[model samples]
Structures are given as C-alpha cells and as structure tokens.
Target: MRRNAQALFGLVILLAGIAAVVATRDWKIQTAMYPRVVGIPLVILAAIEVVLSLRGAPEGERQAVDTALSETLPPDVTARRTRVAFTWIVGFFLAIVLIGFPAAVPLFMLAYLRGQGRESWALSLVLAGVAWLAFELIFDRVLHLPFAEGLLLQILRR
Candidate 1:
C-alpha cells in the first residue's frame, strides 16, 4: 500500500514537471531557462523514484547515504520532526515569495544554520555571504536572468 502511494506521488510529480516543461516550449530561451533547467531534472528524478518504488526493494535493501529514522524514532518523535521540517520548508517558501531568491537564499541559510544547526555565528555569516555572492555573480551578472521582484518589493515601489 505504501509503495503504491509513493509510486503515485512520484508519478504526479513527474507529470507536473512534464507539463511545466511542455508549457514553456513556446517561450524564448531566456524566459524558459529556469523552468527547463529545473523541470528536466525533476521529471528524470521522479521517474527514477517511481521505478524504485514499483520495484519494492526490501526494507533492509534500501540504499540511502544517510541513516533512516523511520525504524529508530518513536512515532511521536517522528511526527514532531516532520512538522518542524515542514515548518522550515514553508517558512523558506514564504521568505522567497516575500523577499525574492537572491535575498532569501542567504537569509534562509543563515537562519537555518544558526537557529537549527547551532553553528558558530562567524561560520553562519561567512556561509551566507558566500551563498549571496555566488548567487549574484552567477545568476545576475553572468546569466542575466530576470528574477521576479517580490510582492513586498513590488508593493513598496508603487
């Protein structure tokens, strides 16, 4: 039952990626760059997931680089951790929507590193600075991608 559900989820994601890629076919190369870059990998990975899920590997045969928490953690602890993870995911999404990616990426990285990971302040600051610099240099300066202004920025400018 779980495997079937996982396969279904992967199929849905694969279909969504295909739709996005197809919808951008008429767009100019500059406009389609982001979607194509993201969508193609999304489709490919989701297909792989669906195939794996359908193959139904034994529980002990799962090949993960990291340890699995599902077997070790108590249900309540797992649920709590899942909630926290989703909270961070939603928070990051909201941050991006509110502030745009170039700003949100470093802010999210710093917040996650300091607040969740409890890294040294200096390390967090340096990592965040590097992330921001790389994003600006690669996407803005080199690729010249036009990122959408955040809703907050748009409203503030008007």
Candidate 2:
C-alpha cells in the first residue's frame, strides 16, 4: 500500500514536470532546461518507481508477510532531511532574489554543505568559495554569460 502510494506520487510529479516543460515551450531557456534535464530524469525515475511497486511476491510457497512485518522500519531521516533541505533551498532562492546570485550562491552552498553534508566548516567554506569562483569567474566572466543581475549587481554598479 505504501509503495503504491509512493508510485502514484512519483507519477503525479513526473506528469507535472512534463506539463510544465511543455507549457514553457515558448521560453527558450526554460524549454531547454526542463525537457532535457528535469523532465527526462523525472520520467525515468517515475517509471522505475512504478516498476518496483508493481513487482510483488511470486506465487508464494509461503508468504513472507510475517518476516516483512517483523523487520523494523528504517528511520525517516531521508524524508526529514529532504523537507529541511528544500526549506533552505527555497530560502536560498529568496536570498538570491534580494541579495543576488553572486552573494547568495556561496552562502547557500556553505549552509547546505555544513547543515546537510555535516562536513567541517573549513571544508564547506573552501568548497563554496571554489564553486563560486568556478561559476562566477570561469563560467560567467570568461564565457560571458548574460547571467541575471541580482541585488549584488546594483551595489557593484554604484
């Protein structure tokens, strides 16, 4: 029953992502980003989930229900972590909107690494800095991407 519910949920999300990609066809950036990157993975994952859910016990000589029921359920750590991570991620995006990507990206990365990865502070900060440098300097600056200017750009302009 739980597996069925999960499969159904995945199917819904998969369809929604596909619909979003289709609906945003007019926007070149969104179209390119969604169908190839997000949509494909969602569809593939949904399919795998559905397959797993549909596969049940073979013609049972003896049902394993007793054994399955006896086994302790795993901790809900993944679900809890997912919720927390998503909350922080949304907060990070909001910060980007107000503070700008240049500043927000590193802050978000560091927080995610430290809070989620449970890594040492020094390592998290160093990794975040490297990521910022790679993206801002190597990608945005060198490649000359017209990356969206955030609040940081306003300050830089002044």
Candidate 3:
C-alpha cells in the first residue's frame, strides 16, 4: 500500500511537470535553445515514471518489510522531518533568488549540512567550497553560463 502510494505520488508530480513544460512550450520565450534541450529530457523522464507506476511493483519481493516499517515509524517523526526538509529546500531556493547563485549555493549547502547535524565546520566549509568550485568554476566559468550575479554584480556595476 505504501509503495503504491509513493508510486502514485511520483506519477502525479511527473505528470504535472510534464504538463507545465508542454503547456509553456508554445510561449515565444520558450523558443530558445535552452527550453527544448531541458524540456525533452523532463518529458521523457515523466513519461518513464508514468509507465513504471502503472506497471506496479516486482512480483518476487515480499511485502512484510513495507508493512513493518509503515507500522514501526512514528507518524510525528516522519511529519517533522518532512516539514524540516521541505522548509530547508524552500529556504535554499529563496536564498538563491535573493542572494544570487554563487553566494546562495555555498550558504545553502553549509546550512543543510549543519541542519543534518554535521558538527565539523571545517569539513562543511571544504565541501561547500568544492561545490562552489564545481558549479561556479567548472560549469559557469568554463561553460559560460549567465549565472545570477547577485548583490556583488550590482555593486560592481555601480
């Protein structure tokens, strides 16, 4: 039952994303190279998810573990963790929008690692720096993406 619910939920999200991509495809702004390149894969993945969900679970696996986990885990704990994770994700996106990609990416990564109870500040810093390097140095710098310049860019412009 739980697996069925999860599969159904995934299916719904996949379908919704596909619908959004398709419905917006005709917009003049979407005619650029980026939209089609991104949209095609999104549509394909969503279609795959729909097919998998409709196919149902594999036959050989016993259902006992699923039932046990569903019963054993406290509902409150699940709900709380879900809420916290969702909040963190939303906050990360908000940070990106407000502070720009370069700054927000590292901050969000550090915050999430800390929130997960990682106590090593040094490790977190290293990880965050590496992530920034990969995204900013490798992707944005090398690939020449117009990454959001944030407050720094605005100040520099002045």
Winning candidate number (lDDT) = 1
Error at 46, model 3, angstroms:
20
Report the CA-based lDDT of candidate 2 relative to the real structure. Answer: 0.75
Given candidate 3, what's the lDDT at residue 93?
80
C-alpha lDDT of candidate 3 relative to the true structure:
0.75
Checking candidate 3 for backbone clashes, the offending pairs are: none
Q: Write the per-residue lDDT of candidate 1 for residues 29-95, one digit (tens) a residue.
A: 9999999999999999998888988998565856679865565787679879899999999999999
lDDT score for candidate 1 against the true structure: 0.90
Candidate 2 vs candidate 3, TM-score winner:
3
Q: Write candidate 3's Cα lDDT for 34-133 as tens digits.
A: 6657767877887676666667646465565643534456878987887887898899887877779888988988887776857589888888889988
Give the lDDT of residue 49 in candidate 3: 62
Predicted candidate 2 versus true structure: per-residue lDDT over 22-97, tens digit per residue: 7657777845774667777777777776666567423346464565432244547666666786898789988888
Model 2 lDDT-worst window of ten? 66-75
Off by over 4 Å in 2: 1-75, 151-158
The TM-score values for the models, in the order shown, are 0.56, 0.48, 0.51
